[model samples]
Target: MGKSGSAGPLMTLDINRFNGVPLHLQISEALRKAVSNGQLQGGERLPSTRSLAGDWSVSRNTVLQVFETLISEGYLEARVGDGTYVKRQVLGDFTATSATDERPLETKASYPFRGLSQRGKALIAHRLGGLTERPTLFMPDVPDLQAFPIRSWLRLMNEVSGRLKGDILVNVSNAGYEPLRDAIAQHLRTARGMMVESRQVIITTGSQQSLDLLARLLVDRGDPVWLEEPGYVGARAALMANGCSVLPIPTDEEGINIDLGRSKFPTPRMVLVSPSRHYPLGGTLSAERREELLDLSRTTGAWILEDDYDCEFRYRGQPFAALQSVDRDGRVVSIGTFSKTLLPSFRLGFVVVPIDLADDFAKARAVIDRHAPIMEQMVLAEFMHRGLYSAHIRRMRSLYAERQAAMLQLLDETLSYTPPEFECAGGMHFVLPFKEGVDDTAVAHELWKDRIVSRPLSMYFSGRRKCSGLLLGFAAFRAEDILAAGKHLAGLGDLIRRND
Candidate 1:
């Protein structure tokens, strides 16, 4: 066993034949430690695999395997006509410092001194401010996961999996799976009365991604965008993350006040609104306000983003058509997600952009994540095409309607707390407004401490017109569970009194 060339120094490696460890693993670990401890300096040529194998009394394949592992992990590199060398700059200047230095290496000092960009700082500061996925009582935005049609879904998944061919697996359009886009387009046309072609449907990871995409593609940094006050925190966060100057417009019994938005930010580049059913506050945009908002978009060249989320669960007279259905000017970008209807883990949502913007949005989406998983998209397309999606939605809608009524009644009975005015239509959650001087955030925190996950309504607002209240969800829990939680909620009056 000897060195293969005169270019590299001879080295000793400790090997135990009877240590019960695989030689390959021991060799890899030893090399890793050596590199980490600066024993193997960066750019230092290593002995040929043949020579190392001879020196260690191992096969050439073993040395080759070890080298391959380190090379794949970026710890080592092989140069043609030269030899295997420790990778340079893989972990900064670890090679530049001599291994025989008198002082010990300050590992922490090697960290790069960098700061987040302006947009990154903005994103970090704008917290979505909500609870975790814990199945706590009164948690908002969580669907009844147990009630989802898993058996049917699994059957469809299997069928799709079996039928997936080379084209289905390897070939995917950047927008999404074409069949899934067709399914979404058809569903929107039938359910929400939207006029959309499959080409306009750009599938996204979820509603958050949709918002972020819109923020990125439509507006630039410091551009003005109007948001509904006491609205969805997620939309606000996404807009701010893109460095959009978010101007909060107030909402009333009617949806967003178009007049106020115009008065404050006269010409914002875009406006994100939940016109079908205002989130948290739960008010559909009045017909007049819809017209006014559309007119504003047409007049000022502003793009209106209609978040028609949770419109599938309306318990009222009839579900309203999406605002885009009435927009003849092609200014509306309709967004929908299955998170509230199906499970949130599905991570499937779609954005229906104007025909002119569709190409750019798809290109941008391709850059963001290439596209969502094709297998799930195929299964969902099959699920929708077979009419299972509608049936599941109808079942969950009915069930949540019952739970909503039961929760409202139980809250009244248990705590003698009933809002004089509240929207009893669609939406997974409802807001209970407190009078002035009550610390709703403190109340929410206290309830959370007791395992009740209620959100402070004030947390949804960034403007001066903050509403103090709690947003309690009823869609995820049973009537009995809500009542049981209501019993605990009844005793929390002392805490509210203390906060007051």
Candidate 2:
């Protein structure tokens, strides 16, 4: 009932296209369909499992499994050393099914996800993009992987594996390790001028976790949270996910316009500030505005989140004083990250919260993720204790400073590009402001084809075109690379201005 390999035909499988399915599964299903459909005739010599695997861009074992499944289903047979072949009875099952259409499975038409608890479905059903690739940078938010101290980290990891003991292995300290929290507190006091105690510091996996914890700690559903317009989109996503209404505070050269933000929200329950060097535009909140914002928080009894995102890379003389330094009302949650300064894999960050809210935040953290890993906490604590962490910051501080200068210098060399309407004070990125009538997004698409990703400032805006610019980053770029990136920007300028 079936033809042989001598049927003189062949079928090929494609694997490069992104079907958005696992590669191996895609391969297996493709082969199964061919065999069941008789397109791959019976008794045909199949490609060597290894050969098929090569075509599929997958491993040989995966192909082997596919072959094995077909054999088990009587659709294929192995002839040992020579090769595998399709079974002669391959068409037998087809005739049995072709006589009449098989009834669809009598499974209940009820919800397939009924078994999942309501919370489970809700958790998975929730959607947020750009978390995996926030800021939409060409380089991405990760560290230069080649530069990670793998040997040192592995040594620390080995030490952890060897010394893991009863309480260390089994106990989950929801408050994070004491050494790590203390170390963060010490670092903040010395470097940031934020007077915080060890108990006031809550270790987090990353800035994201810190944001989520704060949202839960401070915001009730439908409460108002004010953030800089065209600000850190990640923070906006976190607040929105927690059911808070995010009010965008317009940012000027002096950072967020404090009085206007207060007027808009009138009674914002919480305010998020990136005072040292504001995001996207990279402008610092002027001292007057910082004080004014803190005063607003104090008067209104609203909470303040001082997101000191990358203050360590302040390219100038002295760093700005943190808002927490002037926060006598115990209202500020000072968030800082190692992801920017030392490395990204560290996933180590801390939130300096008020003493009264520390316990509650800890409880919320427990519900969220229990706590960050003790081993990482221990290694990072040791790194800081050895002064290595500070040493790295001092080194990278200068490195990013030079990179920033280089990006600016290269921009000056090209005449094609227009000067950005908005400028950064001292941060990793600067927004190139665009005119109101221009289609900034179309320009962004043209740049993508050139492999240069600059974020349109308006993409960060939630309302009408309150601000328009492009956010370029140098946080993870070397000084030389910064020059090239600027040239790329210049080339883009040539293409864009040519239209004019």
Candidate 3:
């Protein structure tokens, strides 16, 4: 006869140290509850430490320690000639009853349904991310896998790993690997003309994570925030999920209309912009507009989030400097991602915050997820430190320039259809606008039937004056491939036009 009562099954205990309580204390508390609740009767012989160890899936020494602790507190007793038993004095506080007299605890129960929180509902309503899962031809924002410098990257990884020590492996900081932050800061100084320091950089998993962190840290529920019309969907979704009242400001050839934004929603708590090069539409925010936005930030005390995604792929004359470079008042948070320049799977990005907010953001990041993988950070740091990162970017830039030209050439040469109009100088994808009345979403779906995947421009807009177009990615495809894709598109154009 084991110590377990016949009327009930053996006691079950789950031990996980990650629950923030010590292992011994958790076990002691569970056993104490069994005694106090009359589940274990007075003078009832308890299971041996070995028996309890087997049942609880814990070490015998751990169970013995728990037993020792409980015995010292008078909840359990030990007899020299026999095994341990429940202390009569402790059990006397409760009525002596068989285990059968007490109802068994149910792990689960049915209850009336309740609604989710408002934020939960907002998140559900505006779903984002997962854009790269089923990548097809012309999928926007995808890097050329064939052109990546895998050999150089692998060599750098080997070099970094060979020199790695215990301290580097275990001493991961919430701010990120210091050397990597330094590398990013140095790169940004020359690349985007931003005066930043390593300490202000907070490494995140991706741009999506950067957005989420900013939403959690700065945005308050129901606070009005300015977002560009036909803007990045991920930004809108993140802000909405945090319960921000999003104000969609319209855009033009020179980027977001600052005067219109001022007229419509003069004061917002936050404003998110892709200033260096806007996504999908591919417009650089004009210098005058940049000054206006900085002035607005200064006057209203509204925070400006500059998403400098894909700023390196500019094929035109010198690309504009980052908007953060002009904000002397530390109100701008500049975000950049290696996901566009490097592989998205790398999952590395950084946010440069004001020096005053650095420590708080670091603490907040630690509470969210400790930090990004240490080894990857080390490898990338070495990659950049050795100048391989800049070299890779230059190579990809040349290759992408060729691909972009090829796509444009094919669109112009294809005789069966009219080429879409474009005004932007650079980005990974080019906007292909359709007639005003045509639904680009339907055209994109029809193109998908021919295995050509392109994002509809209308999908990015959240306002009434939505444009109709397709965002065709050229950076990932070769010249020959782009021409082939154009042929398929031209062939499908007639069918689509006939149906229309």
Candidate number with greatest TM-score: 1
Rank by lDDT (best first): 1, 3, 2
Candidate 2, residue 464: how far the Cα is off, in Å: 1.6
**Model 1, residue 291: C-alpha shift (Å):** 0.7
Give RMSD to native, each candidate. Answer: 10.0, 11.1, 12.1
Collision pairs in model 2: none
Reference-based TM-score, model 3? 0.75
lDDT of 2 by residue, 1-500 (tens): 65343333345776655668766667666766666655666677887766666555678888888778777777778885557876767644443222123435544455574475543443344342232343334443444455556687677778767767878876756778888788888888888888889999888898988888888778898998898886777788778777788898888778899889877678899988888877766677888898898888878888988998877776665678788987888988888888876666668888888999889888888888898887888888877777877877777667666766776776567534433433434566655556665666666666776667666666677667555545666666676766756545664453332224
Error of 3 at 195 (Å): 0.5
Model 2: which ten-residue window has the lowest total lDDT? 94-103
Worst 10 contiguous positions by lDDT, candidate 1: 491-500
Question: What is each predicted model's overall lDDT from 0 to 1?
Answer: 0.84, 0.72, 0.81
Rank by TM-score (best first): 1, 3, 2
Local accuracy of candidate 3 as per-residue lDDT tens digits, 1-500: 53342222378776786989988889888777778767777688876677777787779899889988888777888888577888776733444455555666633344346567777887767543323344568888889887788998888888888867877777878999999999999999998899899999999998989998998999898999999888988888889998899999998767889899999999999999988777767777888899999999999999999997988888777888888787899999988889888886879898999999999999999999989988799889989988989999999999998988887787667733333233436678877766566777777777777778788788898888887877888888888888877666774343322212
